[model samples]
Target: MTWNPSDFNNTSGLHISPKDMWIPELIIHNAVGDTYELRTSNFMKLAISSNGFINWNTGGNTETSCKVDISRYPFDTQTCHILIGKSSSLDYELMMIPAAAKINTFLYDENENGEWELLDTSVGYHAINEQMTFLKCTLILKRRPLFYILNILLPVILLSLMNVLSFKLSINCGERMSYSVALFLTFIVLLNIVADEMPKVSKTISFLQLYINTQLAIGMFITTISVFLVHSTNSKTNDDVTGAVHAVYKFCKLCSKKQQVRPESPKGDDQHEDKYIKSGQCEKLEMEHVQQTPGSANAETNQSPSIVDAVNVIDDTLFWSFLMLFVLITIVFLLLCLF
Candidate 1:
């Protein structure tokens, strides 16, 4: 129906009721919810050109099944697809074609989500089973991690630091058990909270979950060590303590002294102290210096360190070791999850 330009005030297009015309009903094949025909509402209009061509803009919301792999979690990207196919077997009477290979939304994405940003989109026509045709549209999205970092990730990391700090509390110290148990409980609560927001465990396990579980395991280890140290110290004598325990205690004693700055002695005593430091006799020098002090206790000065003393040395040794391990694990997990 070509129109004369001067006949209708130069109007080349007109709007009419969508029900008065035909529309290709594109349905989502992988829909998770009710699959509906992609037809414009009756309240909408179909623009008809003077040459009998029509423009039916059918844009609406859809729910499709999207499988997620959340190993990286808050730092991850997800891809979802919408498989649009004709609702009827009309391959001979009707045909569908993709508008373009790439779908860009710089002009029309006004109500975008705050937590996710669309990264890219592509659409293509595909045929299957020798007869069916469909439009496959892929959408890639990236998560904005700021909300998760503040609400979950940072608090978890901080709680893990508390686990490392608990090693500094002595076994006999009344606060040790309380501190360990409290930290362990905090992790449990946090894990449950995180799990609620995450995909089901049957789907895919995330790195964050594994990281937290490791921390819980370490907490159990520390608690067990504390229980054993408390029990053994209360029951064992220096004679009952094994040679291996004595050696570990002595090694830790030497290690602790190596980190200390040696005090300056008089001019004549310099060579004496030099011999002690060079020959690894610093422990002897320390013993002598304590004995010469004005009010030193004889009970602590002249005997081999008791089992309790050995326990103290072990505590200090474990403190530094576990601290380093915690630091290394935290760094590695952070790098892996973010990258």
Candidate 2:
């Protein structure tokens, strides 16, 4: 019911109290705390028109339950909802209507602040049952990534690069093992820092967390290899090198990508002609037991470098290979996650 505009000095509307009139009672259904009440303002000023239209602006800070999806982490977007209305009353007695927002043609208002941009703010309706209907406000927010990139992302990337270069340290100088161990510890610390900032949920892990984990694994691998390399480099690897040591020597050669082996048969010796020697390309590790006594002729036959020397020979290749691996994976993961 309404009166003529000429009845009250032709005023379009009047500022009045929301408590003075009967309005829909809206409460937060998915509230997290005891603050489910949406009507926090008592002395609310509303614009009451002569035609009985009421623009009652009502809002307050609401702590509501929202599903957290941190798959993109610092570059992530989040959607949260505010469910408003009490389903205690029958649908005919109470119904929710999305109010027209004052600022724009859209149905809901939007305001963005620091760190998070408000991508969308929309009001919608949902029914609990045949007897009840409620209002739902959806909030879509996207994180501002620049701060996180500088503080966390760039540092982690630099650390990864330094981790690969630890292989270039001299094993005998006692720096490689320590350097690798330090990098491993640093990765662990950085991981902890990141974990603290994120919500504890196993549903969907972020790409940033996965990248850090991969780097951690690499750090651990480098540290273990450094330990073995240092120990072997310091120890005397004579003709009595173990099978495990020889296998490691072969692995080092593989890492260096040199000295590919091919089987070749000797034509002169008929007995040995049918036999193919596969270990010829790599130095003949089959060291003959040379007599150390003076005037022994066979002593000069054991001139080939030991497996330890073989490892040292290809250390540079290993360093470069690991560095390249770090760069390639970093670029791939960043590109995939971003695009």
Candidate 3:
């Protein structure tokens, strides 16, 4: 019996039987709108009976009906264009969807008369086919090297330099004020840089923020110590000046007292007598003063102003205070570096 074309879809011709002497072919199409046609002759046959019981045979196996081996087709050559859209939420929720895509499939086969059949169709791959598989995609996260340099290293360096200024500046009001101001400015700049890169989350403390705060604390401590040193040195200097003035006054008073106890010489005698009297009076006064003031007394009472001593005391105190401050600041800076 002749096969009725209207009774069977054209796709049924893709399957064949060995007894029927029919062949089957498969074709594939690509996304670039290219068609690849493949043909096979006598690949399938069928056993036709008077009651229309057609038995299909393929690969030396007889079946009740024809079947097509889709595996023989080059599915790899046919690819679909997949446009994926992804969105992420603040809570780390991710969503993805295929917004648009298209697939092309090509069919080629031979009829019972050995005629060729070729067809091409463009349809949504997912609409007609549910068995299509996709390859697993790997996601990678890459960070720029310069991001760490600018966002981390540069800020830390600036902060460290600001901290170093505490040691370089003099421990005076002017120097302290300037250094503190500069340190604060550096902190502000670093904070701004951190704010730009990090999310405004209440629960997190960035590395840059920690570093800036630590440096600011150290700078404040250094400023306070400097102020204390200046005040202490001035107070000590004032005390020394007061003590020196008091000693000088006491020495002058003792000299005045000795002068008041001495007696004068007689004046109405001859020239030689007057001269001898003056000399005797002077000698007596000297002896009496020497007798009253013994060696121990002289040793105890003698006081002389020493310019060198005053200068040395002032210089030594100031120098040592500044030196100690310098060393302390240096040690603190070194510790910060290590940490």
Per-residue C-alpha lDDT of model 1 across residues 94-174, encoded as one tens digit per residue: 677887888767675634688888888899877765567888899898888899999988988888888878767766688
TM-score of each: 0.77, 0.77, 0.31
lDDT top scorer: 1
Q: After superposition, how far is residue 5 of candidate 3 from its true place, in Å?
A: 15
Candidate 2 lands at a TM-score of: 0.77
| Per-residue accuracy of model 2 over 156-203 as CA lDDT, tens digit each | 999999998776666566667778888899999999999998889899
Would you list the C-alpha lDDT of every candidate in the order shown? Answer: 0.79, 0.74, 0.43
Candidate 1 deviant stretches above 4 angstroms: 1-11, 90-92, 104-112, 236-303
Tell me the tens digit of each residue's lDDT in model 3 across 1-339: 446555666323343444345323322322124333222224545556434455443322211211122111111112223221111121123322222332222232323322112223232322222323221221111223345455555665556555545544443335656666676677777667666755455553444455556666655665565455445435563333335434544554455466585455455647646645564665776668878978865775554434334333333443444455545654554354334
Per-residue lDDT of 251 in model 3: 51
Off by over 4 Å in 2: 5-13, 100-112, 237-242, 254-303, 306-308
Q: Tell me the TM-score of model 1.
A: 0.77
Clashes per model (N, Cα, C within 3 A): 0, 0, 7
Model 2's C-alpha root-mean-square deviation from the true structure amounts to 6.5
